[model samples]
Target: MGVFKLPWSLLKDINKVMRNFWWGQVEEERKIHWVSWKTMGKLKTAGGMGFRESHSFNLAMLAKQGWKLLHHPQALASLVLKAKYFPHSEFFQAKLGSKPSFIWRSIMDARELVKRGTRWRVGNGEAIKIWEDKWVPKLPYAKIMSPVRVLSPEAFVSILIDPGTKQWKTSMVEDLFLPEEATLIKQIPISFNNSPDKLIWSGCMAPVLKETSKMFLPKPTIKNLIKELEDSGGKELVEEFAVVARRDAAVDRIQCKIGIGLIIRDWNGRVVATSRKFRPLFPDPLLAEAMGAIEASCFGLQLGIKRIILEGDSKIVISAINNREENWSAMGMLIEDVKIKLNSYEEWSASHVRREGNQAAHKLARDALLHSISSVDMGIISHCIHDCN
Candidate 1:
């Protein structure tokens, strides 16, 4: 309210209205009811005041909201945050006496409930949380201040490619998250060809130390050093790079949408997956085929399954996945439909299954033709025919 500069009359009236309407309501409410103990150190339990302290109660609510935000690591806001602060310690906290920014403090306070009564990491899983987890201390968050391990690793770097950016990066340790600088090629140009030393053998040499007046040589601990490189921006930048680099050698991926209305499935020998009515939207041959591929991929991602098999009777759609012919312009993004997402999942695979074996997926397509659904209904079926190689 005070941030703006308005005419004297306007400002005066605004302030007057705020004070009379808003302030009056707040003052009146404060007097009406109180949800707190009477400033006593005793528990509100054990026959003490049954009222809840509004201050702590509000703080607890804020804390819960913060937990939700942190829980969704894949969300846009979360992605922005992890990019900011990562390779983090046991947990993050908002300290007393030293106040963080308004937004920061709000997020911290929103998750304050976890700070009280409940302890961090009661379970076995090592969650990237805002509190130091005591259960699995040595995992990611534990700060033991111990000596670094000097050992060789099995998988050093995996070339990764990000379809979104069309860029490449390298991963230091596969199956585990690594920091950015650890993944960057800070050294002079080194070729990856000729089966360059088995990842961990960063050139077999006894540990050497050469320290000058201003420089201290690091006895590089790939593991610990990677942990310290947690700044989220650096982590994502390097991860994206790795994704792109790995993608270069990957098999071509194709995308298209598949509607369930085109195929029928039977549970106990009766139609199970088809929609109730005929859908007029899927009038064209190309659209019907494109939607099939889309439906196949969505199911794969949702089921948390490894691979998907998409089988289509449409030769054009099936050929696109099997690499039989060129894609027509009518197939705009049809080729890009079931692909790209496979880049992130190391275990995931997809193939063009035979139309007979892909009965379940085909059922979804058949159902799509029945109902006038505007939904982009998608499902996944592993391309079991990839092994046909």
Candidate 2:
């Protein structure tokens, strides 16, 4: 399927056979499907069985190859294709020349999928067309929704950038875009070095440095659980070896700055680890809380904790993670990352708590804004929290 596009009729027949097998159809007898193939093909976290539909899967695989061609233009395959099919133009501008080969046609057909998933990371912004390219990170399709009226439709993103300070031209942005759009555009971080614009995938972009080390600890027995409860004043005890992670976010709405605080405890309520990080330009508190959870998950991986009980102050974010629903909003990608991390553990659960129950994490979050520091030992945790056994 990656080499050539399969016919729709063939794909349809393939789906029919798979559906029949799943529904227990005999030689001549058929049973009710009960569920649609489309529903069954959705991700498991989205309440489906995680099946892949053949045609769309084929297109995705082909799109990946097309993506490689665009990013790796100097590769042997790309050079050969460009020399023959688009000698006078780049891949994006290439035409379906006379008698195109099956491979060329297959790749070209998948370009739309690649385009839909691509977004531009603004730098000097000189290379990006303000109205034509997807440079506005917060907007749908990463493009301005307002029609081309304030500025010329041919304007480049550089026109809105202040070269003197390498920051956004605030007054110009307000005059050019809607009030909300202007705010969002300013929140986007600008490169001070005048770097060129770069294309990026908007979906499934995980942290650049992913932790690959694995550490699995032995599960504690009932006797150990009882002993831990006794040592910790019988509060928040679990049935087995578990790590409780309390997370909170401190928000400075006026400055668009946020601090994420995380406290990880053993089943006995001993502070095993704590993390505090400072981030900039988070639009809302919910997003900050979600980001805090992502950091907490990473911290847990660093500490080699496999079983976790995640607690947070935001009910909305906790519910979203626990329910595992399909999120299509701006924070969708963050939520997906948290879910993926938790699913890797042997057992993990998320629950909501009131601010009062998460005060220690709240304090850490506030401190993160004032001081940028991290603690793997009890140094910071001991000072911030006194209930550790």
Model 1, residue 208: what's the lDDT?
23
Model 2 global lDDT (CA atoms, 0 to 1): 0.76
Q: Could you report the Cα RMSD, in angstroms, for every candidate shown? A: 23.8, 11.3
TM-score of 1: 0.24
Model 2, residue 126: displacement in angstroms?
2.2
Model 2 lDDT tens row, 1-389: 88888999998998888888888847688679898999999999997888879899889988988888877889999999999999888667888889999999999999899889988767688878988888776588788887788778899999999999977898988888887788778876565457567666766332222144222222324346557678887554453557799989888877677788888877666677777788665547766887788888878877788788889998777766755344444454566678777767776777789998898898888888666555455424546555533
Taking the tens digit of each residue's C-alpha lDDT, what string does model 1 give over 118-207? 322211112322122221112332211222233223212223222243223333222233332222211111211111211111111111
Model 1, C-alpha of 106: deviation from truth (Å): 69
Stretches of candidate 1 exceeding 4 Å from the true structure: 1-282, 324-328, 347-364, 373-389
TM-score of each prediction: 0.24, 0.59
For residue 44, what is the lDDT in candidate 1? 60
